[model samples]
Target: MSTEDIDVMVYDYTVAHGAIPAPLNFMGFPKSCCTSVNEEVCHGIPDKSVILKSGDIINVDVSTIYKGYYSDASRMFMIGKVDKKKQDLVAITKECLRIGIEAAKPWAFMGNIGAAIGNYAHKRGYSVVREFGGHGVGVEFHEEPFVCHVGKKNTGMLLVPGMIFTIEPMINMGKKDIYVDAANDWTALTIDGMPSAQWEHTVLITEKGAVSLTY
Candidate 1:
């Protein structure tokens, strides 16, 4: 499904379960979903004021609680007819995520996933944002197994079956520097104001491979 569809589904689940209670107040976020469009790196709160346009790329980040378990996922989307440059960026970014998942086999180190993602990003002349990385998710909103998008091979936590986490790679069209908009306090932007894209999935490491729970 499209990122927007996934985003709406997540929000529906959240509202159905009443999971948007205390955290909504605790985090001080204006909305339950984060719909960040082009030039918005992350945490762009969804609002009627910001309507998506054709050729615009957006990231829909969703976090929700279900059956006492929490799940988080995000995906990139092209509002309409995206140009070749943006299309390539989205394609490669998705590939980088796939590559990272491929490295999440049993007995594999978390660093392997990072190496795979970084290597693909580097090869494509893109840069990965290291400021924010993936983390384990289950009962809590965030958990163990910090998954960085850039690292050396055979390092960090080892993957084991039944382990659930996320591997979200935020890629930039230009430099890797990112800045949070002071005015909004929620939106993150690329330092150069260039476009950025991100894709994420809550994955469970199994004996076969990573199973995407939010897919």
Candidate 2:
């Protein structure tokens, strides 16, 4: 299936389960899914007023509960013909996510995941958002083992089989500083007003490697 098909599936899953299946109620998110577009860093609630345009980039974040288990993942996509710079940023961001996932294994430190992502972003002259990072996911919505996007090796939690979580890397075109939309209480944007991109995957660490649950 295409990337668009996967996104639709995720959206449907979230909608079918409704807000009750999401743990955001405890955090006061007030939304079932997040569809953030250009200039909208994260937590962008989908709405009719927000229509995707041809050169726009969007990130769809979805989380759902199934059989008492919760799964979450996100993907970034280009609406149509976006500029080369933005396209490169999006491509590189996805690669960073891939590299992070590759480093997620049994006995691996959570910081290694962030180190891989951060190093790639920095080498490409981009900054990773340090405020919001990955976290453990499983029976509950969000759990232990906080994963920072920028950290030193062997600094944080250790990865082990049976551990499920997400590794989302938010790359900024300019500075790492971010701003939240107080009025809507959802949207997040870069303080410098530069474009940003992000990619995420709900992963489960197996005896061998990590499996993407929401793929």
Candidate 3:
């Protein structure tokens, strides 16, 4: 489906549930959802100008505001007849997200989240995007305690119960450097023109372990 169609679908769904798309009006963002394909990294604008093709891997990011609360998440989708390398990138990117979440625990340092994800991605010959990691979100669209996807363990903020945030890792098959498209100034593209994949979920820190609010 076109990105515009996806945006409408999400907008309607949110309204049906007495909610709203958080990105719809925030910071002048034009779409209800973000659709990033292939080399595109994040904040891609939904437009009728672009169309999905076979073998393409697309990342659909969705965030919703409901009852003064917010939840954010994203997932990758492979079009028909994808290559093994691209397929593996998607799978590994998801695994990176899982690894980060697994490391989030009470009293643990926030840096552990990125260290776990970064180490795994590096070991697999992939680079994690350090420019944009994750952030706290709940009553607002974006908040404090920026979560980095690349850092040293036992550093940064100390994890505590009742903290809400997201762990979204953007993994690149090529170099981690990225550039924003000048035309729109929103879509971020990998500099090497190689494939990139990302996975995200909002989570809540609990006394026991991390609970995925957007799972």
Candidate 4:
């Protein structure tokens, strides 16, 4: 489906549940959902002119505010006929998110989450984007705790039960550097122009473990 089509779908789905799309009119954002394709790292501006094609990897980020609380999540899509290399990137990128979430147990340091994700990504010859990692969410669209995807272990804030946040690691097939589009300032592109994939889920720290709020 086209980006605009997906945006409308998101709007209708959210409204059906009496919730509003958080990204719509959020800080002047025009769309209800974000559709990032290929080298576009994040915050992609949806346009009807852009259509999905075979072998293309796309990330769709959705955020909604329901009843006074917020939830955010994203997933990567491998367009028809995706190659093995790209498929591996998507798989590993998802594993990175899982590792980070698993590291967010009670009494754990925030940096442990990043370290686990970064180490695994590096071992697989992928680089994690540092410009945008993750953030707390619930009362507001974005909050504290500032979850980083790459950092030294045992640093940052300690994870405590009841804290909610997102763990999205943007893995790049090339260098980790990125540049913002001068024309839009919102779309982020890889400096090396290689494919990037990301997965996100709003998580809540609990006594047992991290639970995904957007699941």
Query: What C-alpha lDDT do the candidate models reach, one value each?
Result: 0.83, 0.81, 0.93, 0.93
The sequence of per-residue lDDT tens digits that candidate 1 reaches over residues 1-215 is 33344445656777876775213433687666677788788887666556677899988887777578888888888877999999999889899888888888988899999999999899889988998889999888778988999999999888899999999999999999998889978788899988999999889999888888888
Tens digit per residue, CA lDDT, model 3, 1-215: 67787778988998898988988978888889999999999988888868788999999999999889888999999999999999999999999999999999999999999999999999999999988879999888889889999889999999999999999999999999999999977899999999999999999999999999886
Regions more than 4 Å wrong, model 4: none
Residues 47-78, model 2: lDDT tens digits: 65566778888887877777777778888989
lDDT of 4 at 95: 99
Q: Which of 2 and 4 is ahead in TM-score?
A: 4
The TM-score of predicted model 1 comes to: 0.90
For candidate 2, give the lDDT of residue 74: 84
Candidate 4, after superposition: displacement of residue 25 in Å? 1.1
How far out, in Å, is residue 181 in model 4? 0.9
Question: Model 4: C-alpha RMSD to truth?
Answer: 0.8
Better of 1 and 2 by lDDT: 1
